[model samples]
Structure formats: C-alpha cells, structure tokens
Target: MGEDHMERLIEGHKRFLAEVFPGRKSQFHLLAETQAPEWLFITCSDSRVLPDLILGTGPGDLFITRNAGNVVPLTSQDVDGCTATIEYAVEVLRVKHAILCGHSDCGAMKAALDRAGLDALPKARRWLQHVEAAFAHRQPVNSAEGESAELASLIRGNVVAQLWNLKAQPSVVRAVDEGRLTVHGWYYDILSGRIEEYDEELRKFVVLGE
Candidate 1:
C-alpha cells in the first residue's frame, strides 16, 4: 500500500474509533469471539460500493464476496476464493440467505457488452467470459430511462446469471434443497439509491418492501 494511502486509511480508522466504534462497542465484543452471519452478500468490486453503508447492516450481519463482475463460474475446477467463501457461508456458517447484487454503470458489464474495447486486457477479457450468459438473461430494456436503463438491465442480468451459478455450487444446492437457505438477486442503482429485488416466482423485478 502506498504510504499516503495508508495514512488516509489510518485517519479514517481514527474517525471510526472515535465516532462509530463507541456506540457499538458491546456488539463488537460479542462479534470478536464468534460470528454467525445470517446473510451472504455477493456484489461487484466497485470503489463507490459499500454494502454495510447501503444496507445499514452491522459488522457481523453479512459475509461478502466481491469480484470484477460478481461472476460465479460453474465450470471451473480451480479453487476460487469467492466459491470457497460461499461454500463456507453455506455449509459452515449455515447462512439462511444469499444475495447476489449487481449495480448500474458497472464497468465490468459495460466491458462485457463492448468486447472490442477490451482487446488489450487479455486477462480481463478472459475473466469476463463468465458473463456471456447475461445477454440471454437480460431484462427487457426500459426506453424511458434511456442509456441508464440499458446498463441497469444488463447489470440485473448479471445478477441473475451469477445467482444461477451460485445455486449450482454443491453446498448451496444442498442447503436450498434442505430448505435451510434462500437465494436472492438484487439490482442496486447507485444514482437512485433504490434496490429492486428479483422475484423468482414472478420473473420480475420489484422495489423492495412493495
């Protein structure tokens, strides 16, 4: 880490210690020993994204895994950190719900959609192969929202694609069959600060809480 970057993070930690930590000290102590997080949060690795800040979740409430496109590869035999964490969350932690969330204006999705631009980034181009399924899963684009809708629709499609991949994981498959778990797909629109949940039964996206 850069010295300047470390200094900024330390300064932020100081603020957290002074302002945010005191109010939640008692809760923090219990979490220090053990954590029984109930939710698994899967999202993109975006600088502006913070799950706890957006969802108002406390430290131990969520187990999170972030990646370039929040892509979950079903065919890979190689051990991926995201899959390993998800397996632990399902099998060990026994988390009851797993939320796969994708966001608007996602660089990954945009890159996946525009392949020619990524010709130079061989690794990233290869990594995004996981999202090819998103095109088939895309929601009917909303014309009213213009360009924003196109991106949001694609982002939501990624959530759907990844959720299916997540369900294909052995641990997650068994957990759901046992009725010990539920998987959710979410579209988080940063500009609007609105969260829409994918209704698996309805095959539609609806604003959270009706």
Candidate 2:
C-alpha cells in the first residue's frame, strides 16, 4: 500500500516534468534565479487548504510558511520557525502583504478543543498551547455551520489571535509603520469553498470579494 502511494506520487512528478514543466519553463527558469513574491502567506499544514489553488497564485507569487495550526508565535527568548519565517519575509523579502489564514474543520483546532488524546503526542500538545488564546477571541457562532458552528468560531478566533502575533513581530511592526506592509486575517471554509477576511474596523469576518 505504501509503495502504491509512493508510485502515485512518482508518476505525478513525472507528469509534471513532462507535461507541466515545459509550458512554464521560462517562469521556472526565472524563479530558480530569484524570487520576489509580494505576499507572505502563513497558513496551516492541512492538505485541504491549498493556497495556490484557492488564490489562483503560482510560484513566485507568495512567500509561504506552514505549520499545523497556522500559528505566528509571539516574539520571545526562544525562536520558532513561524516567527523566523515572518521576520525574513518582512525584512529580507519585503513582502507587501502578510496573510494569516486558518481553515475550518482543522485537526489542530479539534485537538485543542479536546486535549484528551494529546498526552500521547507531547510535541503537538506543546505546540498547540499557542492556540489557547483562541478561546478568548472566539467569534460569534454561525448557525450556517450547523453542529460545527462552535468549532468554526474557534478557528476564526485563532486567525485573529495569530494575526495579532504576526503584527507584533519586530520586522512586521517596522514594515507596517513605514507604510510598506499590510497584514490580514482570514478564515477559509473548505465546505463552502469561500474565504472570509477579518475586518479590523468592523471587527468581523466578511466574505472575500463581497
């Protein structure tokens, strides 16, 4: 079974090299030399959340960083991958926009809600502690989500909390103050295939393109 899955991936790579690569050879050649992506996308490791597919962005468009819960850990004595990526994206890449996006039906959020199983996964338990603030920032429950409404609310709240952490990064703070960067918080609903951007002024999530 494992070999079959590996073969499938190998075949997919073969197809990309033979069919897809030729059409975008020039783009790849240029990207290989250097990348000047304008957006810094921080999102979850969830397989269902494909930033390129949903945003219609290809390579060289977004500088991306991913973790289990889409976290942007607050600056501290200890350096984490997420914060280090954010610092580089802001200071070195000079990305114009930084997007902190969380998705619905997230397993990370599920584990956060019920930590009984976390005892077996010590590393994950420690990592999820970053999302504990989500409980305080929970959004108003939406009836449209049915039984998953509460979970969705918590997920959105995580987006907000992490967005705050993203902004707190020293590089991000400097970039924003210089009027060169903008930060956004987003909740992606896999079921509806819709994205909601948090409105800082209104303090609510509004559907993207609406």
Candidate 3:
C-alpha cells in the first residue's frame, strides 16, 4: 500500500516536470533563488485545505506554516515550529498579512471536542490543550450546518482562538504596531467550497468576496 502511494506521488511529480514545470520554468528559476511572499498563511495540516487552490495563489505568493490545528502557541519560553515560523515570516520575510485559517470537519477540533481516542496519542493530546479556549469563544451554532452545526461552531471558535495567539507573537505584535502587518482569521467550509473571514469590527465571520 505504501509503495503504491509512493508510486502515485512519483507519477504526479513526473507530470509536474513534464507538463507543468515547462510552462513555468522562469517562475521556478526565480523561486529557487529567493522568495518574497507577502502573505503568511497559517492553516491546518488537513489535506482537504489547499490554500493555493482555494485562494488562486502560486509559489512565491505565500509563506505557509501548517500544523494539526493551525495552532500558534503563546509560550515565550518554549520554542515550537508554529511560533518560530511566525517570527521568521514577520521579522525576516516581512510578510504583510498573516491569516489563520480553520476548516470544517477538522480532525484536530473533533479530537478536542471528544477525548475518546486521545489517550493513544500522547503528543497530539498535549498539543490540543492550546485549543481549549475554543469552547469559550464558540460562535453561535448555524442551522445551515445541520448535524455538524455544533462541531462547526467549535472549529470557527478555534480559528478565533488561534488568531489571537498569532497576534500575540512578539514579531507579529511589533509589525502590527508599526503598521506593517495585518492579521485575519478565516473558516473554510469544505462542503460549501467557501471561505468566511472573521470581521474584527463586527465580531462575526462574514463571507469573503460577498
């Protein structure tokens, strides 16, 4: 099974080299040397959430960091991948915008909702503690979500929680205070194929582009 999956990935890479790479050879050449992405996209590791595909962005457009829950830990004492990536994107790369996106049916949020199988996964269990604040920030359940309404609310709440953590990063704080950075929270609904941006002024998630 593993070999079959590897073969499939190899075939995809071959197609990229044969078909896709040729048309964008110059783009690849410049990207190989250096990247000056303007957006810092922090999103979940869920395979369903493809930032480039949904946002119509390409390489060199976004500096991305992904984790199970799109978490940005607020610990100054501990050095973690997510926080370190944020520091680099803000202080070094000078990314102008940082977006924390959560998706519908996120496995991380589901696990946080129910600790049923968490005992078997120690590291994941510990990591999920960061999302505990989601319960407090839970948005009102939307009837349109049907059976998944409750879970969806929690997922959106997690986005808000993580967004706050992202803003609290020292580099991000400095950039924002200097008027060089703007942070946003987003919820991507897999079923609807749409994105909702959290409006700080309205304190609600509003549909993007509409």
Candidate 4:
C-alpha cells in the first residue's frame, strides 16, 4: 500500500514536470533563485485550511507558518517555533502583512474546549495553553456560525489572542513602529468557505472583503 502511494507521488511529480512546470517555468526559475514573499500567513495545520487556494496565491507569494491551533507563544525567554519564524519574516523577509488565521471545527480548539482527551497528548496540551488567553478575548457568539457557537467564538478569540502575541514579538513591534508591517486576525469557516477579519477598531469580526 505504501509503495502504491509512493508510485502515485512519483507519477504526480512526473505530471508536474511534464504538464505543470513547463507552463510556469519562468516563475519557478525565478523562485529557484530567491523568494521575496510579501505576506506572512500564520494559520492552522488543518488539511482543510489551504491558504493558497483560499487566498488565490501561488508559489513565492506568501511566507507561511503553520501549527496546530495557529498558536503564537507568549514567553519572553523561550523562543518558540512560531515566534522564531515571525522574527525572520519581519527582520529578513521584510513581509508587510502578518496575518493570523484560525478556522472553524479545528481539532486543536476542540481539544482546548475539552481536556478529556488531553492526557494522551502531553505536548499538545502544553502548547494549547497559549489559547487560554482566548477565553478573555472571546467574541460574542454569532448565530451565523450555527450550533458550534461556543467553538466558533473560541476560534475567533484565538485569532485575536495570537494576533496580539504576533505583535508582541520584538521584531514585529519594531517593524510596525517603523511603518514596515501590518498585522491582522482572521476567522475562516470551512463549511461556507468564507473568511472574516477581526476589526480591532470595532472589536468585532467583519466580512474580509468588506
């Protein structure tokens, strides 16, 4: 079975080399030399949250970082993976927009909402501690999000929580202060395939397009 999967991957690579790569050879060649992505997208590792598909982006367009729950750790001494990546994107890549995007029905948020299954996963439990701050930032439940209102509220709150943490990074703070970076929090509904941006001024989630 594994061999069959490997064969399929090989076949796919061949298809890319033959059919896909040729049409975009120049684009790939430029990317081979260097990448100067403008948007730093921080999102969940959920298979459903395809940033490229949802944002209509392709290779070299976005500098992406992903982890369960889309977490940004809040420790001054500890250099977590998420923060390290943000520092690089800001200081080196010089990305202009840093977006923290969370999604509906996220397993990480579900795990956070219920600690029943937490014992089996020690690392995950510890990592989700970052989400505790989300409770304080929870947006009022939106009926539009349906029966999973509690979960959806927490998800939006997590986006806001992480967005602040992203801002707290020294590099991010400097970038923003120097007028080099902008930060955003976003909630994506997998069922409806719609995205909402958290309006910091209004303190509410609004349609991303609007």
Model 3 global lDDT (CA atoms, 0 to 1):
0.92
Cα lDDT computed for each candidate against the true fold: 0.89, 0.92, 0.92, 0.92
| Candidate 2 minimal-lDDT segment of 10 residues | 141-150
RMSDs, each prediction?
Answer: 1.8, 1.1, 1.2, 1.3
lDDT of 2 at 158: 96
lDDT preference between candidates 1 and 2, better one? 2
Q: Write the per-residue lDDT of candidate 3 for residues 80-169, one digit (tens) a residue.
A: 998989999999999999999999999999999999879999999999999998999998757878448789899989999999988888
Q: What are the per-model numbers of colliding residue pairs? A: 0, 0, 0, 0
**Candidate 1 residue 102 C-alpha distance from true site, Å:** 0.5
Candidate 4's residue-wise lDDT over 1-210, tens digit each? Answer: 599989999999999999999999999999998999999999999999999999999999999999999999887467778888999999999999999999999999999999888999998988998899998888886787654889988999999999988889899999999998999999999999999999999999999988
Q: lDDT by residue for model 2 over 14-65, one digit each (tens)?
A: 9999999999999999999899999999999999999999999998998999
Q: Tell me how far the alpha carbon of residue 113 in candidate 1 is from the true structure, in angstroms, after superposition.
A: 1.0
Q: TM-score of predicted model 1?
A: 0.93
Candidate 2, position 6, lDDT: 98
Error of 1 at 37 (Å): 0.4
In candidate 4, stretches whose alpha carbon ends up further than 4 angstroms from where it belongs are: none
Cα lDDT of model 1 by residue, 15-90, tens digit: 9999999999999998999999999999999987789999999789999999999888877668888899999999
Off by over 4 Å in 2: none
Ranking by TM-score: 2, 3, 4, 1
